[model samples]
Target chain A: AQSVTQLDSQVPVFEEAPVELRCNYSSSVSVYLFWYVQYPNQGLQLLLKYLSGSTLVKGINGFEAEFNKSQTSFHLRKPSVHISDTAEYFCAVSSLGGYQKVTFGTGTKLQVIP
Target chain B: EAGVTQFPSHSVIEKGQTVTLRCDPISGHDNLYWYRRVMGKEIKFLLHFVKESKQDESGMPNNRFLAERTGGTYSTLKVQPAELEDSGVYFCASSQPGRREAFFGQGTRLTVV
Candidate 1:
């Protein structure tokens, strides 16, 4: 079974402040990792994914994440946040094969305080 | 190109009522998935369809829930006699074969009172 754990349920940060949302996962086999963001009343939008190659991945809206293998973590970060960045973030995992099922975390609500 | 689309963005019904949600995936995408997020819970996978065939349904809660992808184009998920526990946001996603990323729809918010 593949499962994703988003450590924080809510995060508050001032505008232009740096922030990080932690995520961890456990899987018996090789897996793919992804981060998605959802604005109020909207569906999930892909931010970034870690399928192969570099451990550091860059995504839209000045967001990025690092995949730490030993720690089993995929933490999302942003150097400076904007009020528009306030949204719910989710970490997801899937097996490393074609048509694999994707599992998602509980989600972290990022509240950007202007 | 258009993204995935789902209908009845919000629905409210009493317990034991029936509801059917619809989804239209992006054109040419062969993979469609169903997921749900209950109150204060993570989004959980419900099923996957590949070109009108069910690929995986291990996450389906029970027989009360049924999903179908007719003609490999649009899909529908029906919940019969829904319980209070079934209230949540239902999301539909789609991706082309061999793609790692899946695009999501706006989702159907079902409120079972």
Candidate 2:
């Protein structure tokens, strides 16, 4: 069994300020973690993913996430924010092998205020 | 290359009405999947199709939902007598054989009144 949690429903940050969205997961077996961003009226875009090797993975639009196995967490962070960055972010997980279904959190809405 | 495409981006129908949503995935992608996000709920997987065959449909809510992929190219999801609880955004995605990553469509927002 696998599950993901994103405590914050919404996070408001000012322009150019650093922000972090926390995500935690629980899985019985080895897993793959991913973060996706969905803009208004747009599809979910891949922000980043952690399959193996590096614990810290960087993604598009300057968004990066660090995978901490011991803590069972993959938190996304960005040093600066822009108006265009306002969107909903999702954290998803899937078991390591085969064509498994992904489990997703409720998602966090990021409101970047200029 | 074109990304996944879904038709009738938004639809509002009365309860007991039937609706069909369509999807056109990227060319040559063998793995296609469907997911739905109900109001205030997390997105959940509905089903997956490998070409013209149903690979996994354990997430399908009920028999009211029917999915088919003709010739392994385009797919359609038909909902018969949709209920109010069925109102949500339906998403379609496709990936290569390995399932490394999947590309998503904009989603079809269905409102069953």
Candidate 3:
């Protein structure tokens, strides 16, 4: 069984400040990590994914995340956030063993204060 | 280029009533999935379909729910005698075979009154 834990339930930051959403996972086999964002009353949109290759993965809207194998963490970061970036973010993981069952975190709501 | 689409953005039904939700996936996406999120709960997977074939349905709650994907295009989920616990946001996602990322629909919010 695989599970994900998002440390913070809500995060408040200035409009131009950097933000980080921490995520950790527990899995018996190798896993693929992903970050998704959802606006109010909207479905989730994929931000970035760490399948393989480079640990640092860049995504749309100037967001990025680093996959740390030693720490079992995949934290999303953005150098500067805008009001448009305020949304609920979710961290998810899927095992490489063809389980195909993606496990998601509870979700962290990012509140951008102008 | 259209994303997944679902019918009846919101529904209010009494207990013991039957409801059927529809989903139209993106063109040519063979893999379809069903997931739901109850109040204050994380989203949970219900089932998966690969071109009308059941890939995995281990997450289905019970026999009260039935899902079908005919013609390998659109899908439907039927709930018979829905209980109050069945109230939640139902999401439909679709993706191409072997693709990792799945596109989601706006979702159907079911309220069991």
Error of 1 at A96 (Å): 0.3
Candidate 3: give the TM-score of chain A: 0.98
Clashing residue pairs in candidate 1 are: none
TM-score for each candidate, following the candidate numbering: 0.98, 0.98, 0.98
> lDDT, candidate 1, residue B43?
94
How do these models rank on DockQ, best leading?
Answer: 1, 2, 3
lDDT of 3: 0.93
Which ranges of candidate 2 are over 4 A from the true structure?
A: none
- DockQ for model 2 equals 0.81
Weakest 10 consecutive residues, lDDT, candidate 2 chain B?
Answer: B95-104
Docking outcome class, model 3:
medium
Candidates' DockQ values?
A: 0.86, 0.81, 0.72
Candidate 3 Cα deviation (angstroms), residue A59: 0.6
Clashing pairs in model 3, backbone N/Cα/C closer than 3 A: none
Query: In each prediction, how many residue pairs overlap at the backbone (N, C-alpha, C within less than 3 A)?
Result: 0, 0, 0
Superposition TM-score, candidate 1 onto the true structure: 0.98
Model 1: CAPRI class: high
lDDT ranking, high to low: 1, 2, 3
